[model samples]
Target: MSLNFNKAEFTRSAAARSGFLRDGRPQFAFAGRSNVGKSSVINRLLGRKNLAYVGASPGKTTQINYFLVDQQAYLVDLPGYGYAKVSKAEKDRWGRLMESYFQDEGGLITTGVLIVDIRHKPTADDVTMHNWFRESGCPEIVVANKLDKLKRSQVEPALELIRQTLELREEDRLVPFSAEKGAGKEELIRLLCEACGQ
Candidate 1:
């Protein structure tokens, strides 16, 4: 499968303060903790650097940003789950925002791409979100990002652990991707297209 993507446009906040209600199109989201290269991965997916705005620090992205890609689907960059720098109130606000996005705005979510650092295993928040996706009936792809940071043989064991933690089925694909080196980019794009029914 080939995906020809145009430029990506960013939104400061979701429509209705609800993470984009109105359902622009079938959408896929890149979700992970802050500083996990979620923005960089999205940028690489569309073959652009500044498309998703990688922050120099965690909690820099305080809002749910939506990027329209190729006029067919929206690539959502959700606020990172765990950021230590932010205050409790700010974190609570983001929690509310994410709750709205996940519960109320699921109609637009065709597939959710959960990213985790290859050097580290999945966190409690990551496992919780993965389980929520499974229970919510949303198609999901668990991405092991930053594979270049690890030895090749180390990838599968980490992948297996995440699959086990998430209770992923045998058919589910755990892709080891690296936005820095462009590894696994094509496979991710293919999965995105399949999720979008392209």
Candidate 2:
């Protein structure tokens, strides 16, 4: 079964001391550096423009946004990290917020979808997050976003570097996705469903 993108609902933030309201339902997190199109991917998955706020600003999403799908799973949009121009103090706050979320008792992150720009390989921050996910022992699916902007031949080496840096296993899948063109959406959906145990 596919993840039914029913509606984008605002859930209570655990960092705000609201606590996790739902339990047992699996959650899939979308994480990446600032301006990596986290919001755009969510919009593309749900086929709704402005659903997740496609902003030009680097740190557009400050808080954790949760979208419940079919009341069986959650699509979590985390605030982008490693954005320039943000103060060190602010970054510290984000770090703490993320620490709390990832370590939460109810935060069963079955899959981590790491987005990366196809042209620019994985940044230092990207590698750090990739390592964190592995250390956290969560299944990860890294997607090379914005494939439409890159040359066809340039895609493989870029993805290969990410695979090597992340030490991805042979079974792990890396998809080159273009949210604008709706490419790789079906494969992503199938992966998500399998990850979420749906």
Candidate 3:
């Protein structure tokens, strides 16, 4: 049977490694910089307005949050990176937390979704996060989010720039998306289903 992502529900948030879920369910993690609309994308994917908490302040999400989809798989929301307001000590803590999660021996993550702003060139932090996903040996899907903010003619060029900047391979999936307007939501849901083996 196919999984129903519409049934996704907030499970828990883990600030430390000890708090992470360990039930052996397939996990698809979302990673991106602060203000990249990662939370908005997740909420849109789940068909909820605020399931992932669209914070007004950038870098408000400081924990690894887990949302269960139909009780079949897990949607992991990693902390947003690259916000300058945070202190160096806090940044170091975030780094350690992310490293431990990725380096986990439990094989929790099956795939990664890296979100970036569609209008701007990929930032240095974006490249670093992309490389981390690649180095983790997990298949990744890049989403150039906030697509509705661009002109129709600018879409292709913007996507191409993201593809080139991220150094995405030909086979890698780079989806142009808009959480507000629901653009590319189906494609993303299909990818999530595939990641969960649904």
Candidate 4:
């Protein structure tokens, strides 16, 4: 049976590795910089409002949220990284928690979705995440979000910058997305469905 993207439910939030789901389900982990609209992208893909908790002030939430989609696969929301205003200690803690998740022997992430703002160059943290996902040997894709903010002629250059900045190979997928206007939703859904083997 095909996976139903609409039949999603909030499963739990994992503040630490202990709280992570280990039921052997394939996990589609979405990651991004703080304020990159990671939640918005997830919500858009799911065709739901507020399913992933779009924060007014982004980067405050520091937990991994697991959402069960169609009782078949898991959409894991990793904490947004590389935002200012957070304390040094909190950042360290977040770092450790994220490291643990990546280093996990059970292979917690089946597919990695890395979201970046299309208007700016990818940050160091973003590069680190891309490397982490690559090193983990999981199927991954880079989503250039906020596509609506760019002009018609600026899109290609922006995407190329992201691709070059991330050192993405030709086989790596880079999707231009706009969470607000629902552009690129179908492509993202197709990737997710493929990841779940639906």
Candidate 5:
């Protein structure tokens, strides 16, 4: 089914598990490092400039922010991880929150989108996030964001590096995306629709 993404809007931000929405709509959780441009990717996908709160500083998203798309599925914006400036206590808090969300057997997440910088190799945090998605039994889609930073000739090699570093299955997807140029937006939306069973 085709998703009418034009109707997307900000839903709510949850700092704890108790605040998560229980309306039964499938959620595609977006996860990545603090500076991976995850929020920019979400904004680009929704065709809105600021709907997802692009942060000026790294690791600005301290909660799980939900955006309802066409009032059907939800686009869950998970807090950015791997920011070293945060205190150990804060990191532990974020870790527990993320673990609870991913470990839930009720299947709140319909899919997982792991965004990474297309210009660099995937970091250790990226690998851990990928594993969490796999352990949760949610279909994983790795998005190599910031595609505009690479030259045309460099795109293929960059994508290849991301594929190998993430150790993705042949069936898994690793899309080359550019939030600034809107490249791969349609493909990402199609995947999201497929994940949510629209």
Candidate 6:
């Protein structure tokens, strides 16, 4: 189950279901709010500064990105959710794209990696995304990003809030991660490796 995280490379982006790759490789799908530093966490994970586009503006990533890692697994980056400035039509398109991907029974998704801002409770859209992952019936991991923004005393309560808000099961893996400093990266990498084995 060993993986060379450093060997990661962006493969393609899918703007629709027809564009999704279904080559049977394990897909570790990462989903998060538009402004929750999703791209930053992904960049940190791959140890690449800008491999996964860190948009100058929130909601800029409107497509699903697939990155091949060590030529084995796919790091699937789902579109960011809950951007306030987008039009209703744009939001609906995002919703439909997400729904279609999740609803498909091809099992393209192997693991669901949901990232959230550690400083706040999960939003309604986050909960919806979490539930979609659960419904997909695959193993799920929640990464609490932006951990560096919080004080030491505020960490536990913030994590607890995320736990309760997402209603994470006991078996779920919740990682408190600081993308800026690489804290918790190993644990997350371990989980992704385990996902590859599964």
TM-score, candidate number 4: 0.96
Clashes of each: 0, 0, 0, 0, 0, 0
Residue 125 lDDT in candidate 2: 86
TM-score, one value per model: 0.91, 0.90, 0.96, 0.96, 0.96, 0.97
**Candidate 2 per-residue lDDT over residues 19-126, each given as its tens digit:** 544577777788877888878888888778877877778887777777777667788887788774678887787787777777766656778888888778688888
Q: Write the per-residue lDDT of candidate 5 for residues 18-103, one digit (tens) a residue.
A: 98887888899999999999989988888888888787788888888998888888889999999647888988888988898887
Best by TM-score: 6
Relative to the unseen true structure, what is the C-alpha lDDT of residue 9 in candidate 3, on a scale of 0 to 100? 89
* Error in Å for residue 28 of model 3: 0.8
Q: Give the winner by lDDT: 2 or 3.
A: 3
Q: For residues 16-113, write the lDDT of model 4, one tens digit per residue.
A: 88998999888998999889999999898888999998888878558888999999889899989987468899888888888899989999898999
Tens digits of per-residue lDDT, candidate 3, 1-198, equal: 257878998999998999989998889999998999999999998999999988888898888999999998889999999873889999889899999999888866889999999999999999999998898889999999999999999999999999999999988999999999999999988887777673
Give per-model CA RMSD: 2.1, 1.9, 1.2, 1.3, 1.2, 1.0
The lDDT values for all models are 0.78, 0.78, 0.90, 0.90, 0.89, 0.91
Model 1 lDDT, residue 192, Cα: 87
Clashes in model 4: which pairs? none
Q: What is the lDDT of residue 115 in candidate 4?
A: 96
Compute the lDDT of residue 85 as modeled in candidate 2. 66
lDDT tens digits, residues 39-127, model 1?
88888888987878778887566777877776667788888878649889888888887777777633557788898887786888888
Model 6 C-alpha lDDT per residue in residues 65-171, reported as the tens digit of each score:
99999999999888898874788988888788888888877977899999999999999989999999999998999999989999999999999999999888799
| Model 2 CA deviation exceeding 4 Å by range | 6-17
Query: Using alpha carbons, what is the TM-score of model 5?
Result: 0.96
